[model samples]
Target chain A: MANDHILKRFDEELERLNATINEMGGLTEAQFAKALQAVRDRDTAIAEEVIADDARVDALDVVVQEQTVKMLALRQPMAVDLRVVLSSIKIAAALERIADYAKNTAKRSIVLAQGSAPPSAVAGIDRLGRLVRAALKDVLDAFADDDVAKARDVWDRDEEIDQVYTGLFRELLTYMMEDPRTITACTHLLFMAKNIERAGDHVTNIAELVSFRNTGQNFAEARRKGSGALYTTDTAP
Target chain B: MANDHILKRFDEELERLNATINEMGGLTEAQFAKALQAVRDRDTAIAEEVIADDARVDALDVVVQEQTVKMLALRQPMAVDLRVVLSSIKIAAALERIADYAKNTAKRSIVLAQGSAPPSAVAGIDRLGRLVRAALKDVLDAFADDDVAKARDVWDRDEEIDQVYTGLFRELLTYMMEDPRTITACTHLLFMAKNIERAGDHVTNIAELVSFRNTGQNFAEARRKGSGALYTTDTAP
Candidate 1:
């Protein structure tokens, strides 16, 4: 009976952790959506809202970490439970980082909003932002459903994000080269686009964690690198 | 006697974990140094070396994580010991990220070498890169000695890096506006400087982890923000 009670409490805590992870993901999704809209529409109001909401995501990460440490100390769970518990910390950290990147874009968006930006550059960044947000949504679902296939799919699709970013990179350079007057706003747009691509990379990281949690296998050997990925990431083979 | 023996093994494991972390840090330090030199000298060979050496840091991170999980499962340490074990993971992750940023700089350095970059922009990034490396060294020492003061110092000094970065950001823009031909190289330099700033932020993160590990007190409340940090980070209190 004591063992049963302990197991019940463990399950409850696990459920709570899962729920919190979802909340963080959901908040980041909303934040990124607002951030993207702010960038697309040049809406500082939405950008400010996105900026303020980042703290909540950070707070959620703290919540997740505290719970993870408590569970590790108390439960000392082994095998799959252990992987899930540890992965929660990694996933939450990754999500917080993803949110951080979104916040960065929002900050730049405010600056971009204040000035006139090159249309092609703005449109290019919007495409990148939407793609990044879509990847975030897909990876979170992969995490929730324990769908390794979906996680792998998300991992594989990050190349598309990089391809778009590289193309946009060239376009931004061309814009600055063609018109020196637009240099300031174009510079801000450049960082904003890079931040979104970095966000997409974080999504791939979450997908990797999800795959690790489900299969208990290391994906390092099987990791695939898109050629365009090196242009931005340069973090892997 | 059996308990004493088990305790001895735990101590040995922790010592090994610490060694692995130091090894990782040393490798990242060396890698960043090479990356900086590569950028300063525009030496593709050194840049290539820095890029190739990143895998060692990644592998060391794997070692730290695996050791951390095993220690947590077996030792089930509480209080300070647990914090040390946990901080090892965070520290390794941060160091790996710092190295990743350095690798990025190296990749850009290769492209910059093939072209004629503006002298002022190149000099500006060198200064930023040096400051970032110095912070990394200080934070690592703080972690090793459990020097809370040094850790706090590193945390507080990041603003200087941000200020430098912000100044460089403007200088790059001015160069791009003045000479459109320099746009490609200056843009690469711009991202390299930002990556260096981000690396400085990771040093602050390691400093925060050190403070947490030593004081067992959360310093999130004591966090400081620099005005220039907003131009770059914008992720703060």
Candidate 2:
């Protein structure tokens, strides 16, 4: 009976941890969308909101990490439970960084809004943001369902985000070269694009972690260059 | 007698971990210096070496992390020893990232070397790299000597890095606006500078961890914006 009670408490804590992570992901996704909108619409209010709200995300990150540490110290869970706790800690940090990046993008948007006309070159930025958000969503879903196939799909999407970033880079460069006045805003957009690119990388990290949790096998092949095909490997098999 | 033997083994393992970290820091410092020279002097060979040698740094990071984990699992260290093991893991990851940034800067040097005039605007980048490298060295020194004051000094130096990054942003913007032909290389340089700036931030993270390990206090003041003061007040004092 005592063993059963302990197991029940462990399960409850795990559930609570997952709930917090998902809530944090939702907040991050909302901020990412607002950041893009702020850039496109030149909405300084929204940009400032994103920046101010970053503290909340930072606080949540600290809370989640503390909880994970406590669980490690108290429970000393092994295998799957241990991996989940470890992954939660890292993924929480990654999400907080993503929020920071979004806030940075919003800050740039404010500067760009105060300056010259919005450059048409930012179309790629919007697309990249959507791609990364979708990737994050997919990774979260995979985590909830333990669907390794879905995680693999998220990993595959990173290449697309990278391509969009490359195209955006070229377009932004052309804009900056054409007019010196556009330099400040265009450079800000460049950072925003890089942030989105990094968010996609984080999503990939989450997906890899999900796969590891479902399977004991290490995904060493996916860590290398030109490893795009490795992302297609179905962890279900 | 068994407890005494375990304590001795734990101390020896801790000493080994510290030595490895110090060695890793030295290698990273050397790499950063060589990367800066490669950019300034257009030394392709040195740049290539930095790129090729990144694997060693990554491997060292893995080894350090594994050792720390083993200690935690086997020895079950408490209080200060536990903090030391945990902080070592985080510090190893940060150092690996800083090394990665150095490799990134070196890679950009190759592209910059291909330019017609060596991108006259790279002076800001040079300054930023120097600042970041110095900050990293301070943080590592603090870790080695457990000097909380030196760690606080590292935190203060982050602002100088941020200032240099801001200046570099404007200069790179001008380079991109000046000519479309310079776009590809200038964009690369921008990413490199951002990487270095991020490396500095990671050093700050290490500094905070050092403080946390020494004192049970979290030092929440470090998270405040524009708190560029070189000294931290001990709450107990």
Each prediction's number of clashing residue pairs: 0, 2
Instruction: Report per-candidate DockQ.
Output: 0.46, 0.27
Can you write out model 2's per-residue Cα lDDT over A1-237, one digit (the tens) per residue? Answer: 987887787788888888888888888888888998998788988987887788888888878966776676666678888887878887787888788888778777776676774457667788788888888878888878889999888888777777777777767767766775676667677777777887788888888888887785545553644323311211000
TM-score of the A chain in candidate 2: the value is: 0.90
Q: Report the error of model 2 at residue A85, Å.
A: 2.5
Q: What CAPRI grade goes to candidate 1?
A: acceptable
> Which pairs clash in model 2?
A176-B177, A177-B177
The runs of at least 3 residues in candidate 1 whose Cα sits more than 4 Å from the true structure, single-residue gaps closed, are A1-7, A217-220, A226-237, B1-6, B218-220, B226-237
Kindly list the per-residue Cα lDDT of model 1 for residues B75-133, writing each as its tens digit.
88878989889888889999999999988889888878888998778889899989999
**Model 2 lDDT tens row, B1-237:** 999999999999999999989988888888888888888788989998988888888888888966875676678788888888888888888888889888877877776787753346666677788888888888888988999989888887776777777677667766666665666667677777777778888888888988878885555764754223211110000
Residue B94 in model 1: lDDT: 95
| Tens digits of lDDT, candidate 1, A95-176 | 9988988888888888887788987789899899889888999999988898999998888888888888878877887888
